[model samples]
Target: MTCNLAYNPRFMFLTKTIRYNLLAILACLLWSSSFVTTKHALDYQTPLTLAGLRFVLAGLIQIPLCGHLLAPLRMLRKEFFTVLLVSIFHTIFLYGTFFIGMTWVGGAEGAIMIGVGPLSSALMAHLFMHDDKMQRRTLVSIGFGMAGVVLISLASKPWSPVGLKEFFGLMLLLSGAVVSALGNVVVAKRKGGLHPIALNSAQMLLGGVVLLLIAFPFEGAANFALPPAFYGQLMWLAVISATAFAIWFHLLSKIKVSKLNLWKFLIPLSGATLSWLLLPDESPTLPSLAGMALIVAGIVIGQRESK
Candidate 1:
């Protein structure tokens, strides 16, 4: 006879694990749509300027929502070094390279490239943490995840770029992913007593300011004046950053980096879907369908009870 899962301890435990996994999945989904949104926003502003402004607004919005800016401010005295490191890795380098990279590639292609992030994180974890060694399950998941990204990339998009720009852009994004993996390790390892949301806001504010500084010198003077529609997109991007990063950091603090990153394989699947749906000229091709299936299968295996 089939057992009632409600009374099964293993089933209950698995259910709880799935629930937390959903939070990270939600964050990935939000981040995936950013390719579409960021691409659109870039039409109105330079990449660096748009990225800097988005996170700055996100940081400002988050600080007040966390009940007080002062708590995060105070943590600077004690956790300033940690926060600074996070700002550099998580915000500045990660997002900086991402924005610049976006300039060279289409939304769907960029999103697919981002799918490799989990593999990168897994490698980083294996090298850095003694106990976080890659197991058979991780290798299998990585195989599926990498295959999925490859399949999706094979599907041609109308917006796909040709020539050297795309190559350079992808290289930058790859570099960003490598360093961003390190940021994940740092967040999981070095999170202090400060609340995750507070830490997220502080790091974002600092990094956003630095990005803005870099933008001014390279992209010319900033202009707050823009169409109201552009501001709407900016606000949505900010909300994505504020909410998703908070959820991500909170989960990172509790979960093992190697396993947690496995869920990021869903990013390209969701990102490509959003792009295909939202972009006027884009549509899902056969390879994309196959790719998404592989990503789903990989994530399912990743969630199994294994080290």
Candidate 2:
């Protein structure tokens, strides 16, 4: 017997929309896990070195699948430059500050700060993109998400007589958020025929190379030796970076950036949970749990509104 629902165009569209939304959520989850993994990797390597190596590894992993060594050569000059701009904002500035900030802040704290990216992205999209204009519901969702982040940050005591290192870390994390939001706007604004995988690979490779070059002057290449555990963490970070960026860019190509970015509210929740489970010193307090609950609620509301 044929199912009438299967033949219904509206129903089919809804199913596909849900599938794409799920993909965005999955990407958020993968990205959220990075806070913890990056924190672990930082213990064995300097921030710049770790950032450079992680993305370089990720770019190498995606090379064959994206186009081996001929991908960038195939891109038009304009497209190549667009990808380079994306690499600058998204990889070099975003992750570079992120890794450095994580050195001073805890993984959970870093996650909360990064949680601000969704609101930033939404505002940027509304301002810059015609089709991504913000609605009442989006404003409400952003309010909820930002409130949750505020609650988490307060509960985490990020501002109670902040030291120099903590203050610098907070600034860096917020800067990363802004750069990341700008990158999302750039990607959404791009009208190109380049494959998403190719774009992702080129940006990561270029950004990684830039980071390594920057690292050479300040961090140097002397302390490259690390244990087996560090290598494992490095490989895992590479997998996470490659997979998450690919999924995220593909979703950005398909959907509204505002709607897609709403899923990033889950990052703090997931990152905090993972940090609690893995790092004994990073357990969340009761208020932090309440903040996480608000974050989850905000995500749910945003998801429903997106539909």
Candidate 3:
């Protein structure tokens, strides 16, 4: 026999909120680990090639889960164009810069750079989304987050000169974050009228094909043969992309963009922690830890004020 708890409205609401929060946290965990996995995969493949293969695999995996094979065909013209634009910003520019940037920076450092995404997204949403205007508390929280990024950058260059490669990597990462922020705003703006899975699948497939086409011309004579471990890394990265993005899109459909995106602060923390444990070269210094603390504090303040 199944047991049922008496349903109080408050309890039910709390329970639902907890579940959604847990799902968001889980998505962030998977996404954070992706930085390390992408770094590993880059050892065997160029950035564009790796990104193309990863997204193609993820897109194909999502297709069957979409239930209807012709879902894209049913979308309105406006919705189709919106999805295509999201593909360009979200997949092409975001992952292109992300993967290429990782080639120049350590996994943990790259992850820290991605910490800027939520703050930037919040600012963009304040400009574009009527319901998500930034209040005084949000402004303060953004200031804290920005300070944390500054601290992390300074910590990375305490004694030595920052090399050109490192500077370029930082720029690429910032570019990726900005493009990703724009994509988040776009998705939040176009809230209804299409299934999230279908949208993701279409974007991944289209974006993956585009990346591959570009990879062929620019990164000719690409090698596919690699160690067994490299293939494992590829598969894992693909799975992470598929699962994290699916959950993220679903959450975006249900939650306010500003409120939901505050959870992104966890990405850098998780990424740095996992990279420290998994990759010897990615251990965090003292100032980096302090910077992470500040970022976390900013997120806590933002979340409390939002509530």
TM-scores, all candidates, are 0.91, 0.91, 0.87
- The TM-score, computed over Cα atoms with residue i paired to residue i, of candidate 1 is 0.91
Tell me which of candidates 2 and 3 scores higher on TM-score: 2
lDDT tens digits, residue span 1-307, model 3:
7545557677787787888788899998998778667767877889998899898888878877888776644442447688788888889898988888888876436655776787788878888889888787776776676667656655654434559997898799999888888888888776775688888888888788888888898887568778899889988988888888888888887777777877887776665577568766666788878988887888778767344
Question: Tens digit of lDDT per residue, candidate 1, span 159-267?
Answer: 5546798988888898889898998888888645568888889899888989999999899977878999899999999999999999999988777888999988887
Q: What is the lDDT of candidate 3?
A: 0.78
Write down the lDDT that model 2 would get: 0.81
Q: For candidate 2, lDDT tens digit of each residue in 110-140?
A: 6567878998898888888999998888778
lDDT of each: 0.84, 0.81, 0.78
**Per-residue lDDT of 102 in model 1:** 85
Tell me how many clashing residue pairs each candidate has. 0, 0, 0
Q: Model 1 lDDT vs. the true structure?
A: 0.84
